[model samples]
Target chain A: MQSRVDATRCLSCRKGYASHAAGTCKECYEESNHKILDLETKVAFLQFSSSLDPSSSPCFSDVVLVASHDATDQTDLAPPVPIHAHKAVLANRSPVFRAMLENQMEEALSGTIKISDVSHDVLRAFVNYLYTAEACLDVKMARDLLEMAEKYQVEHLKAYCEKLIISKLNPGNPLNSFLSCVLASKHKAKNLLDAALSLIVDNMDKFVELEEYEELKKDHPQLVFEIYEAYHAKQVETAALKEKK
Target chain B: MQSRVDATRCLSCRKGYASHAAGTCKECYEESNHKILDLETKVAFLQFSSSLDPSSSPCFSDVVLVASHDATDQTDLAPPVPIHAHKAVLANRSPVFRAMLENQMEEALSGTIKISDVSHDVLRAFVNYLYTAEACLDVKMARDLLEMAEKYQVEHLKAYCEKLIISKLNPGNPLNSFLSCVLASKHKAKNLLDAALSLIVDNMDKFVELEEYEELKKDHPQLVFEIYEAYHAKQVETAALKEKK
Candidate 1:
């Protein structure tokens, strides 16, 4: 009887629970633990040490990327810093780079690929992510990287950025949500679009009064129409559910 | 009373249990599920698409690895097929490759690394593992790759191969265990050494009569002594436990 009573106690929390409060069977809990450990090991194996340090021996960098704006700044006496990287890594990570390099384009012939309208720091981070799929990102950095990732067709990095942006979206920050929606729609980020749209729809009274929303309506009226369409569909669904009840 | 009974049911197995049979509390189980999902996402993000296809556009391969035996066979009309790879990837994955390539060694200058005592298929798999961190291994393949992984100081691959080899280790096959012990000792694989030693110690009587054991005793007497020492220590520990009880 004592053993049976003990058996009802939760293995993880060590608290006694009735069947309704129980989380999992012993076998499933144990299996999940093993799966977590295995996944961690695999993640460790797959993660690469970022080849960002140029001074490190045997970097084997075959190409250099220079930010175009920085390069053309004639007033600056010091030359624009070039970010060194492997062509193979760039080609593997980005279809844009693959086509540019593989087709013997001007960038391929010159060995220096000039990226337009990007800062040197952002370019460095972008190249670093090519080698190591990691970036320390805040909202602005995520947005910056997302733009570059979208242009380069690095879907993994784009998805990562979108997730970060969506996490930061708040009901109180309708302007930010509106801007994120615009960015998501521009980049074909369906997940971010849906998240931002839902947030805006839930707080529509507050969202419509934002100055940014007025500007967005003038510039991207098609997007505003889509949002209205989504809002209407949600309303219809809620009314139908209420009727069913 | 019905609702209270329902609350104690296991969430995973969907069965009722007393307090002792519960695996985890609700909070821990939910957290574990979230952790598993996060880890799986991380693994997917970190995994690189292997750059192994030579004919693929923009492969950007700057170095080739040739199997030494295949290269020397003058009678064969077909030249030894070289494995295409990037020096950056090789350097990133292996300290040996880093040293060889970064120091402007002959192989670095020539862009052709001659790997001695490895077959073409094994060499190809090894390079693929460097890029993708994946390999399909049987016992024989695991042993072969383990040797290369040890030589190149690819700790991730070595650990992976050791894990596979250990999983395949069976007490019924004492000779296989003995050989694994020897290999582990030679390569300083502590985990494999411990597992193989435990298996051999547990079945010492059967292990002692094997012809491979006699050969191991003759050639590697120190390893045989270590195994005996472990067996004696285990026996002493077991006797002490019995005495205490």
Candidate 2:
């Protein structure tokens, strides 16, 4: 029970601190602690097993999703393994799956849905996210999942993949930036689109010399226009700020 | 920016507060915000729907839990409604369920698992907690669920119910306190048991005169001995403190 003039320990880390280093007062600290505890409990309640084994039936999956593209791989020609999952989980996470299942579509009756344009690994990762809402992303996996998320109307996955793409964004690697821009436009990922556009605009001189830029101009010319548009907008904004100064 | 000498407004609630009312430093505030966002995302990913519809198969429930006690309400001759649930979810939440289901027990073959003694409402709440880790609990429901959680060996749910029960404990209500003591002891809810026993000992004079105390003594004389033991122990401790003073 010291006076306000005396230094207090932080409620979070419990380290001694002056007023300037204060995180919160005792009242606020206790309130935030309770809120965090509540959130953690909710997370615990929501968590299901991450097991994807068909035999285990971790979430007791009623439907199985198979990657059709896996058939193209000559290494394992027998058949593509199916990913087991539940319709209710799919419906809760994605409206596309919900409608497909609820309507008793041909796929629902057959109990197997084939997903094309995705390898078995990517399909597995996508289905895993549907059940667990988690993914480990390399650049290619993130790109593929971002497109799939957009196609499936899974906004959470799309936003998550977009963040992953942005986190790996490198201005020095303009080819990566260029590819991200094309992917962003195709998926309508505003965050990724903005990030890639900014990188391309900032490194215009270096990026224009690359062969990928010429290919992008020939392939995705509309996406190139967006970069120019953002570049000019940024220039005008910077000039306006200078004039105000 | 104002100097440390001038009180800064809280970033959290955005209130004009003095230094004494500080919630957190700017660094900790931003960090906590990010932490909360991460936690919320995890919660979103973990959340499975709480639908008990058999046809809906919210988590693709393989087993149906029927409250056997509900059949004993002779006025309703019809069989009790079965609560649909996922074996994977039940197995993940309770080791008892996992062992039973995995070992190919009679209940596993039957597809309908009979849970005796609990009513339909309690069974539904119990299954709901398995999927969502949440229960709308009053004191009686909390006690019942706590016992059920203990029976199922679902420590998370048991701890959750114990916290709720303890949070709502009223020391003045000795009848509630006495019952909680017996209930807590039965379930081995150390926190609740300790709290209830402390309350009983503190209000010994008023509590002993209550008719419920006599009933508890007649029914569970062992519990009565525990009360006296705790009371004498607390008295000895108090006397020691007095001697030291």
Candidate 3:
């Protein structure tokens, strides 16, 4: 018991006095251990949470790191050729592209990353997307990262962007289009099905139509009906508004 | 010109005169003709709009008309059991399904036909959606009514219920799945995507490995990276609530 008391002193102080007292004693040791364990657990929980929740973790630290790293690379030094700038940009100068590059510089300095807020590279990619309606995304990239784009709410840049590539390119390079669709769909990429449909509908001519297709059509009238109805309704609303004027 | 005036006056009377001085006068005749043309234009606009925005139109009235007009002696009394309720009622008792049915009943009795509120059959279909997901939609019906759902902000339901049918179902049949992905993605129906993915993902054995499969197993993550990033981040900050004990 005396030996145990000797071991029970405050870790901060090497003194052995008042071993039974709460603050600097045996009781304190036991209490602090529990407190330390709780602190460690909470720290671990937060660390895990920060990694998962990028926005909450630290203000765009990862974005700054990745962007800075990419910028430092010699390969990214040259002005990226804007793939599909607006017609005005192509005809004159890519103001949007320039503005986007400036924004990237600001973001890099501030150490912030809103995926919706484009970098020069992303803007160039966006232009490329607008013109080509797709981009050659790294097929081998982890899906979780691609999913992150969706999580960050970067509209038109996440999985749907990938869907665009799959649908338009149909690269058929051992990439899974279906999984891409699922991820995009999950992430609220609105045009995913349209993109998929456009791709698959066109492809059905090349491939044999599935039996399930017929059944789905029979059961789901809202599919085509809504399209027809929307087209007509818009026409009617436009006309009504015009007449009211 | 005199006859034209008389014709204009007659039209203004029928169409609700804008001003008393122009009632049935020569100017009124010209105005009435313009009004008729405007009405025609408005109808044309509605037609186009309904086609573009399928969900808003709810073409149920048209479907009902066609089903009734084209009925055969052997036709069933229940309007083919409205495809939506048949599956759920056949499947099991579901509370969401019941709530949807109640909502539909309210819409029908209300008789307002607001773009957001739908009739009983559509509500039943929505309930079916809560159960089976977007997989078994009647393409035309789902597409036509989706706009209504979107307009009214039943966004989650719209994403899950109708768009699933649109993306999964064949668009070639009377029920085209044209609005499938576009609307669903817009409304952020991740489950719908998952449902469609299950139906659509090709040869999963080829792509997903055993370990990867285990990691990707969850329906939703504890710390979702996208929309809730900021919210989750806030969680990290308030984590260490100092307990007195």
TM-score of every model versus the real structure: 0.88, 0.86, 0.18
Off by over 4 Å in 1: A1-23, A50-58, A71-78, A211-213, B1-58, B71-78
DockQ of each: 0.56, 0.39, 0.01
Model 2 lDDT tens row, B148-224? 89999998889889989888878778888888888998989999999888988998987888877778889989988
Q: Which numbered prediction scores highest in lDDT against the true structure?
A: 1
In candidate 2, the residue pairs with backbone N, CA or C atoms under 3 Å apart (3 or more residues apart, or in different chains) clash, namely: A23-B23, A23-B24, A24-B23, B61-B85, B61-B86
TM-score of chain B of 2: 0.87
Please write out the lDDT profile of model 1 over residues B1-245, one tens digit for every residue. Answer: 12455445666666665444458878779989988987776666555575575555327788999888875555577777788888877887898998998899999999999999888878888988887778998989889899999999999899989999999999998889988988999998989999999999999998898867678899989889989999999999999999999
User: RMSD of candidate 1 to the true fold?
Assistant: 4.3
Query: Fraction of true contacts kept, per model?
Result: 0.78, 0.40, 0.00
Instruction: For model 1, report DockQ.
Output: 0.56
Candidate with best DockQ: 1
Clashes of each: 20, 5, 72
Please provide, for model 1 over A112-197, each residue's C-alpha lDDT reduced to its tens digit, 9 standing for 90 to 100.
99999988888888887766677888999888899999999998899889989999999998888888988998888899999999
Q: On DockQ, who's better, 1 or 3?
A: 1
Per-residue CA lDDT of candidate 2, range A1-245, in tens? 23444555454554445655545554665677677888877776565565786556544557889888786784664678889887767777887888888788988899888888888888888988876777888988999999899989988899999999999999789988988888898889999998888988998887888976677888988888888888899899999999999
Instruction: Compose the digit string of candidate 3's lDDT tens values, residues A66-93.
Output: 2233343347556322221122111112
